[model samples]
Target: MRSLLSRRFRATRAVTAATAVLALASVTGQVAHADTPAVPEFDDGFGLSQVTEDREVHSSTDFSITVTTPEVAGQHKIRIFLPSDYASEPGKRWPVTYFLHGGPGNPDEAGTVEALRSDQMITVAPDGGRKGWYADWLMQDTAEGAANWETFHLEQVVPLIDANLRTIPDRGQRAVVGLSMGGFGSMHYAQTRPDLFGHVASMSGGIDFGNYAVRGAVVATELNLTTAWCAVSSSRGCADYGPVVDSDAIFGSPYPVFNADHIWRSVNPAASANLAKLADTGITLYTGDNDLVENHTADGVDIVTSRLDKLGIPSRAVNYGDGSSLSPTCNGGHNYGCWAPAFADYIPRLEAAFAAEETK
Candidate 1:
């Protein structure tokens, strides 16, 4: 497998350029149809048939749900894969893994499909609201843009998936994983609400918002004029959408600071003291050494892991072998390619986490 770093760098460069163009056009009042599919829909063994209770279970049919939250409204097209024995053992609850997507996009990539199959766990990939940070942002036009993804995941998606599918609703049986932005979201959500998830993983995730703010600003500048960048300040009319308070607090500040600390403290998990709370739960952190893009950095993971260590929190961090930067492939990088295989490797560990929760 190509190292996570190489994949992240390549993917980030591609996404950055693409996002810049989109943001510039949007800011210029160039409204485009939002109905276009963000990613191509394809099956990677997720739709295969299975046998249960001596009966064949067809995988052609999967659930597609639309979860509308106050902050943001979007669809969660899910592919529910029951274990081979699920049909035979009716009413048995199984662990669920909420897989997330990178950037402001869909999780229908090839690698993601493969991960769903290899994990054989009930996988849920909801569209992570507008801007794709999976968090509320400062831009008002994108006000509804900042989907309360955290709330949606815990309150809406989890319960709905559990109720509608054959999933173990207990917190212990639940987990989340993602790559790039999705990776950041997984760890952020897990750290913020440890009571809800047992195991969390990120593959070449962009976990540090402090770093992202600078990169995002740079990308915004490159994509559009300075006026477009300035417009982001007013959420109501701004075309460039992103977190509002980052640049003011981190990069420049002349007068005595008020609330700047709190603003900075809130978004960066590395700055939060509550991160230790996740230790009582469990965390699986992984990134590639060469991932030196906007958010995918060894330094980012190192920052979080170091904090966890300080709090005596038990966690696992892995760095894949060395390789040049590559886009997420079917087999490697932060995209579905690498995520699918990694998911397979983590299945037993996730099952054990669920089992441990059961005993408790």
Candidate 2:
């Protein structure tokens, strides 16, 4: 039930930092809400389902937790990589950084455990499933049930990390970061649950799923909603037929189906009513210039940053690119070339945040 370093995926060499990048242009938009919505309560019980050790050259204590979802009856896996010094430091409580993987994750994915082990904070990576997107799925079949990733992570996983591991266990000590689909998940979580995370970053992620074009392309994936997120290929198609996707999934299908105004009111971070709630939270968003397939990613960063600016929320949005215009160290792409360095650079910021909290 547990994996070792022998099961680790070969680490890809991290690319250099981005030297050249784009900046999001100024934009004007009305924020939907001034205060965040209330956090729903859930039954909380977390324990280590299992644990394993890997003595590979770069190995630490590994954890496997089985979480039960709200509607689903099956157990999901959550893998964790403790700090390299965890075993030696018996009484220390390290901070935690949650790392979310992209959609339709590779079956053999071992996460960035090896690359991030050197950091002092524990790295938590959960199996969000091929299409979970970290959102509570609407139970389509009462018999089988849906994957309630949101509840499992917030209610169970976070508590388990604190109870079982040497963790600071404070909201100010927690951080979350992700790439692509995981990026969207990170922002959504931070926006929805500001009490749980102090810092959040999204690299090459889609934050504006309310946009029909963005929604259509994302849901077009076999893992997402398939044909449900779209009726025709055009944004206008959503106007005539309401939303093409099921209302039960992701956000509940409100009455006004076709209008994005209702569908993403509670979900889309960039367009949600609680967008201002992230003002106090540390926000870092970036995307690669050469991410052709997900070109809208950078645009999503722009949308959130713009809204944050209007609400007086400070954030940094970097547009990384290949060394063409400036002395670029990081290459622009959707793969490891961009994500690796972004993650590497972010860890220090997380540490600093925790340090600042300790002083206060």
Q: Per model, how many backbone clashes are there? A: 15, 5
Q: Which 10-residue span in candidate 2 carries the lowest summed lDDT? A: 9-18
Taking the tens digit of each residue's C-alpha lDDT, what string does model 1 give over 220-277?
Answer: 4323334432322111333443344333322222222675445435656565475766
Tens digits of lDDT, candidate 2, 51-87: 2121111223554444555534455666667766775
Cα deviation at 148, candidate 2, in Å, is 1.1
At residue 215, give the lDDT of candidate 1: 41
Model 1 residue 32 lDDT score: 26
Candidate with best TM-score: 2
Once superposed on the true structure, which residue ranges of model 2 sit more than 4 Å away at CA?
1-44, 47-58, 66-73, 106-110, 113-115, 142-144, 222-248, 252-261, 323-331
Relative to the true structure, how large is the alpha-carbon lDDT of every model?
0.54, 0.61
Give the distance in Å from residue 155's predicted Cα in candidate 2 to where it truly belongs: 0.9
